[model samples]
Target: MIAIQALRAYNLFYFSLLSVFISFLPVYLSYRAVSPSDIGLLVGIGSFIGILSQPFWGMISDRRKTIKKVILLTLGLSLLVGFVLFQSSELWLLFLLVGGMYFFMLPTDPLTESLNYRVAEQYGIHFGSVRTFGAIGFASASLIIGFTVDQIGMDRLYWVFAVYGVLTYLMCLVIPDAPVSSKRLSAADLRRFLTYPATLRFFLLILLAAIPHRTNDSFLGVYVQSLGGSTGLIGLAWFVAATSEIAFFALLPRFLRTGREIKMIALASAIYVIRYALCAVVSDPMLVIAIQLMHGITFVTFYTASIQYLYRIIPEEWKATGQTVLAVIFFGISGIIGSFAGGWVFQEWGGAALYLMMAGIALLAFLYSILMWKREEREAETLAGEA
Candidate 1:
């Protein structure tokens, strides 16, 4: 019971800190006089580093059979590097530090999620129930941190991060590590897992779906500002989006039924297309913020379903590594393309054009998801016939 509470608390505080970073970093970079193109490059480079780092740490966790130690190590280093990253104003320094920070920080999320699912299974608790705390933390922190940053100035952003970081680290100290699979992983197992037809197809699908999501994540704050919105409004937008996720996550099991994850992904992808298209047409910043309400619906549906689907397809022994790979695709490879491409588009064609482009990509993802779902249904039917 204590372990369960500790997991919940850790998720809350951890995502609270993450909210500040995700919602404000671009804004902070802009405040520091970094150009949009450069901000994209910095973010892109950081994600590229995340691509390399996530696998390294995931393999370590898998090999050593300890999620807690890796998370603790990464979080400790990230806090230290983040302190310096936030203080630096030079563009080159910013690039250097962002990569260093992301190397440690990016992997922490997947590890926590891997832990969340493991703990949920062990305790016979719903994973979504525990994950709901993270959404709450993100929603609450965005509002509070937005207001606090408005009052205290973006230069002091590090102070807010530090407080949350310390709290999150403390929470981690108490959360028990989840049990690992006793089957030892081999090099052949790793190679075969990566090369598996289903694994490859699923990853391709996630990559398509995540690109637009990551693009929006990289530029939403700047887009709000472009539409003459204040920082507080940016906070409000994220707050609304995240708050909307809580109900969906909490009630997920009620609606998310077995074998529906793929269908849900398709549905979410369709929503993404609509959401981005609507945002493309909106002239008012508040309208854009209003469109953000769709984020909760789209992200929770798409991401949670993807994670659940991953769990179904991956080997139990490779859970950490599989989860980490999912994170890498969502936050790393997609991030690199999204950040760089989004930065370029936002710079050259403006927000409308950028969002329109996103809508088009989302359309592709939606169509592809439909096709994948159909294929899966056919395969299931064939297996049933054999049985």
Candidate 2:
């Protein structure tokens, strides 16, 4: 019971810290007079660093057989680097700081989720029940910080971020460590894991589906501002989107069974098609916020299903590394492409055109999902035949 409470508490503060970075970092850069394209490049560079660093940290956790230690180390580094990052106004210095911060910051996401999943399964707790606190934290933080930034100015973003960071660290100290894998993992073992046909296909699908989602994450606040919305409205926009996820996540474990994960992902991808299409043409910022209600449906459905399917296919011994691979592709590679291209499109053609391009990409993901669904069905049939 104590461990469960610890997990929930840690998630709440961790995601509140995350919301500050994810929801407002780009807006902060804009406020600092950095151009959109430059902001994209900086974010892309950070994503690239995440790609290089996430797997290294994951492998270290697997080798050491400890998630908690790795998380603590990274969180400490992130806090140190983030303090410097927010203090800098120079473009070149900010560039270096962003990379340093992201290198230690991004890996913690998958590591924490891996910890959350493992602890939940060990204790017979529904994962979503524990994970719901993260959504609540994100929604609440987005609303509060948006208003706070309006009052205190974006320069003070670091103080809000630091408070949540410290809270997360303190909570992490009380949570129990996850059950460790007993088998020793080798480089050859990791190579073999990546070579699985299913692994390749699954990662490709994640990359395709995640690109537009990540792009929106990188730019929606900026887009809202471009349409003449204030900082408070940006917070409200995220609040509406994130608050909707609370109900969906709470209900998910009941409806989201094992084999149904991929189909759920497909359904979410199909919805992304429509959501991005609407975002492409909407002129009113309030309408954009209204459309964000779909975020509850699309994001929770896509993220939960994808992670569940990943766990099903991965080997138990490589759980941390497998989750890291998922994070690299979803947040790292997808983030690179999304940040770079989104920045370019926003700089050159405008947000509407950028969103139109996203709609087209979502359409492709929907079609690709149909193919994956067929593949899953065929594989299931073959297994049943053998049985």
**The candidate that achieves the highest TM-score relative to the unseen native structure:** 1
Estimated TM-score per prediction?
0.98, 0.98
Candidate 2's residue-wise lDDT over 1-387, tens digit each?
Answer: 988998999999898888888898888899999998999999999999999999999999998999999999999899889877876789999999999978999999999999999999999988888889999999999999999999998888889888888998898888888888888777777787799888888888899988999999999999999999999999999988889889998988887998898788889999998998998899999999999988988888988898899888877889999999999999999999999999999999999998899988888888988898999899899999999
Stretches > 4 Å off in candidate 1:
none
> Any idea how many clashes model 2 has?
0
What clash pairs does model 2 have? none
For model 2 the local lDDT of residue 239 reads 89
C-alpha positional error of residue 272 in candidate 1 after TM-score superposition, expressed in Å: 0.7
What's the C-alpha lDDT at position 362 in model 2? Answer: 85
CA-only RMSD, every prediction:
0.9, 1.1
lDDT of each: 0.92, 0.91
Worst 10 residues of 2 by lDDT: 184-193
